[model samples]
Target: MNLYRELAKEQPYFVLSDMQASMGMDAEAKRYMSENIRSEWFLGMILFNTRLLHRAIAKGVVFAAALTRSPDDPPRTKIQFVATREKALELLEQWRAQADGGRG
Candidate 1:
């Protein structure tokens, strides 16, 4: 998180791959993820459901295509669930380009 705060020029995109186990975090870690790690940029989670409505209904906020709702701390972290790492990185590129004034 320190590195992201210091170096990330664009929005922070967290890649949750086979780390589903990691999601079962303890209170402290879960609190940190839910509160401290606010991603206005995007959060690409590698899960099955990519539909906005489903995510909204199940997780609170919705994620459709490359767009997502910016939810504040409390309910959950704002995350966009992708299918794979490639897709996640693609979303990161999209965010980077957007941050870079749509250059390249």
Candidate 2:
């Protein structure tokens, strides 16, 4: 989280997270992290090589984002789950293009 805060000091950035070897988070930790994430500086994130359970949890987070975010606020972090690194990179490129106003 410190790293994220430091990076946010510069500019909004996207994260390509490789979760293949991750031990996965519990509900409490997930809630804490989600509550702490500042949408103003988090552009988006792609989780690649995640386990099936993690993918399902990611989907829930996406749903929560849609429900909790206000229409008046700037875009929140867009989270995506992919099976492979190549696909993750492809999606990241698309996100970059979108963030760049289609200039990327």
Candidate models: Cα lDDT each: 0.48, 0.77
lDDT of 2 by residue, 15-95 (tens): 887876566556687677666766566678799988887778666766666677788874677888888999999998888
lDDT of prediction 1 = 0.48
Predicted candidate 1 versus true structure: per-residue lDDT over 1-104, tens digit per residue: 56655544565454444344444557686545444443443343434324554344324323232144334432323355676567767776775586578887
Residue 36 in model 2: shift from native, Å?
Answer: 3.1
TM-score of each: 0.43, 0.69
Residue 97 accuracy (lDDT) in model 2: 88
Off by over 4 Å in 1: 7-21, 40-79
Clashing pairs for model 1 are 43-80
Of candidate 2, the 10-residue stretch with the lowest lDDT total is 33-42
